[model samples]
Target: MPIALLLAVPLTRAPYILSFSFLLLIYLTLAESYDVLSGYSGYMNLGHVCFFAIGGYTLAVIVTKFSSFPLALAFLLSPLSATIFALFISYPLFRLRGAYFAIASLALGILLYYIFVNPSFDWLAGGMRGLMINTSENRSIISYYLAVSIAIIAILTHYSIPKTKLGLALLAIKDNEDVAKTFGIAPYRAKTQALVISASIAGFAGGVYVYGIGYVNPLTVLNTEILLTPVVMTLIGGTGIYSGPLTGAVLLMIIQEVLWVKITHFHLFIYGLILVLVGLFMPGGLLRQTQIQKIITRLKG
Candidate 1:
């Protein structure tokens, strides 16, 4: 799939499609990472994008301050930095259940955005002025490759979860944490690990994104769209499996790109319409369409 995407980049030779694919890849990673927690573990993290910003800002700081660092090291450090932050916050955040946890995460993200945007914090981050990272002539190509790599990693992580004890514990907890605890599955441990993994992937994606954009501001890196779009994509795709988020991201990106070219203000309306229709009839997502299931069954048969 990655190879096909890479090959298609040049074969089509259309600059806009390449841009669309870049957006698609970024959202695909975000959606899949969100699914690791919200979909499989049934924990809605409304502020999943915080980790993305963490990674982005971390990369920006590193690359900006220490210009001699290897690009690969900067990329690796971004997600690692986010994962470290995730570990610190997971314990306290996981204590709350349902809406409380969701709201807390949302608040945390907003708080970070405002704090970083403050001029007083310019020493830590760039505040309102933001930071611009050095870029190369082939920066776009590099960003695309990095985005593709992270998206693949996110998908692999999703696929791998169901195969491990941690994944089983997550699934068990998703169904019922109390029951999972009774089964000797450590819910706290599993939840923390899930959060860490989810955050790390998001951070990695953010680092790539900052490199792509050539700048990182609080608003640009930590936007509400980043926080919400993954939720929408995960819900639309089918939460139970890996392909669901990918499907959701691809479809939505295409729709947004195609429509925005014709009707500049149609994306949100279309999202609302899709959500409404999904809520009315296809809550299980496109992967769960009756025909899709039947075809899968027959193919396996």
Candidate 2:
């Protein structure tokens, strides 16, 4: 509610204020979803954006072809498609641990990119040129609401999952797979569920993003920058708690927006320098600063 109010109030009634809020929500969802699997479960999935792209493309194909379906329905289906894809891939992929798992996901993402770009699949996805979506004039407002709702849902889901029996199982697996197996935790299954849940939310975000942007292509979907953005956000925000990703996303987005306008070409260099300094001085993330840690410690004490 506080976040919503912060988003609602503007220094001036500029449309860009709303747009920034919408983008912030989008990145928040993406970052939080990434945290679920990678941060909490200790499974590093480098292909998180693949699930996101799948969701966006799934909705795009559906809405573009069958204009009769409600946008909400299409949005729902996008995550379902992502879940199905995750289910199929998780079994084989979970066998690989750590770097191997990461590589496999990255490979899968690249493979999917190729598939989407293929001429044969062009009928479904509109090929390498991409599909342009026609949206209502109030698309920005609609997108803002949708993005905020999705961000809330993602945060709730992340918090809820870690408290359930299944979440306990996942935490066990994260701590020690061999020990988790002794307790019948089934690391593979837990990992798969985490992947599916994370991917589904990411895909849902993608669906909303497509509507927000009105167009998508291989360049947008397959870009390394898009894939890394959530990872960076998660790391910067601190990953263990619900607010970490949200903090990271907001901070990073603000920096990106403000710095890019002032120094376009040096933005990436500046971002890199920030990351380096953060790593050296505040390895736990900006949200995990000494002051915040002290407060948390005092509260626990």
Candidate 3:
């Protein structure tokens, strides 16, 4: 698939297809990261995009202010910065549960959005004007590889977790926090670690995205689509399965492309419809179907 994508880049006259492919890769990483916390550990983090925003902003600030800085250094520090922010907030945020936690995450995202856009922070965050990355011939290709690496990491982490002790503890916590606690599992530790891991992956992807796109504004970098799309893709493909996010990202992205070609302005409307239908007819998600599950099992075996 990756080879096909690379080949398609120069073969096709339309350059936007490559753009869409990059987005698909980004979504795959984001979806997998969300599944780690919200799917496996069962924490709905609406503010997850804040980490993505932070990573992109981190890299953007460095590149914009210091043109001579090494790109590798910027990328490294971006996700690291996100991890620090995640650790600082994880303990207090994890204390909330269910709807309250969801609300808190939403509030946190909004707060960060305003912080970046506010006039007071213009010197630091670039305010509404935001940051512009220098464009280059290899930028898209570089972005593609960076996103691919992160996507691989996200999926592999998701796949390996279910086979480990931490995975079992996370599943137990997801199924019943109190019961997991009774079994001597530290719920706070497990959840916080998962959140940090999720945030870190998302941050890395965001950095890749900004690099590819060649610009970063608060509205674009901190878009809520980052939050909703991952959750929707994860749920549609079936949470708790390692490949669910990958399938969901592929299926939904293709659907979105089709919609964009056909309806254009109404693509978002159709996206919402697809999400509703998935919720109504297939609560467990498309991949959880018996036939599909069997095929996946055989392939894995």
The candidate that wins on lDDT is: 1
lDDT, model 2, position 284: 69
Model 2: CA > 4 A from native: 3-13, 279-283, 295-301
lDDT digits (tens) for residues 226-288 of candidate 2: 777888888888876788888889899988998988885877789889878867877668778
TM-score against native, each model: 0.93, 0.91, 0.91
> Which residue pairs collide in model 2, if any?
none
Ranking by lDDT: 1, 3, 2
Q: In terms of TM-score, how similar is model 1 to the real structure?
A: 0.93
Model 2 worst lDDT run, 10 consecutive residues: 3-12
C-alpha lDDT of residue 165 in model 2: 78
Give the Å shift of residue 163 in candidate 1: 1.2
Candidate 2 C-alpha error for residue 150, in Å: 0.6
Best by TM-score: 1
Q: Cα deviation of 47 in candidate 3 (Å)?
A: 1.8
How big is the positional error of residue 272 in model 1, measured in Å on the Cα after superposition? 3.1
Candidates in order have lDDT scores of: 0.87, 0.84, 0.85
> lDDT tens digits, residues 1-301, model 3?
9656655564574668778878988889888888888888777887888888888899988998998999999999888888999999998898999989989988998889889999999987779989888887888778877887898899998898888888888999989999999999999998888888888998898899889899899888676765578878887898888889889999988987788888848776777888789989887778998888899799999
lDDT of 1 by residue, 1-301 (tens): 8568564684586777767778788889999999998887888898898899999998899999999889889999999999998998998899999899999989998988998999899987988889998888888878987888889899999988889888889899988999889989999999999999999999999999989889899888677766678888887788869999999998878777777788867677776887788778877788889898899889999
What is the alpha-carbon RMSD of candidate 1 to the true structure?
A: 1.9
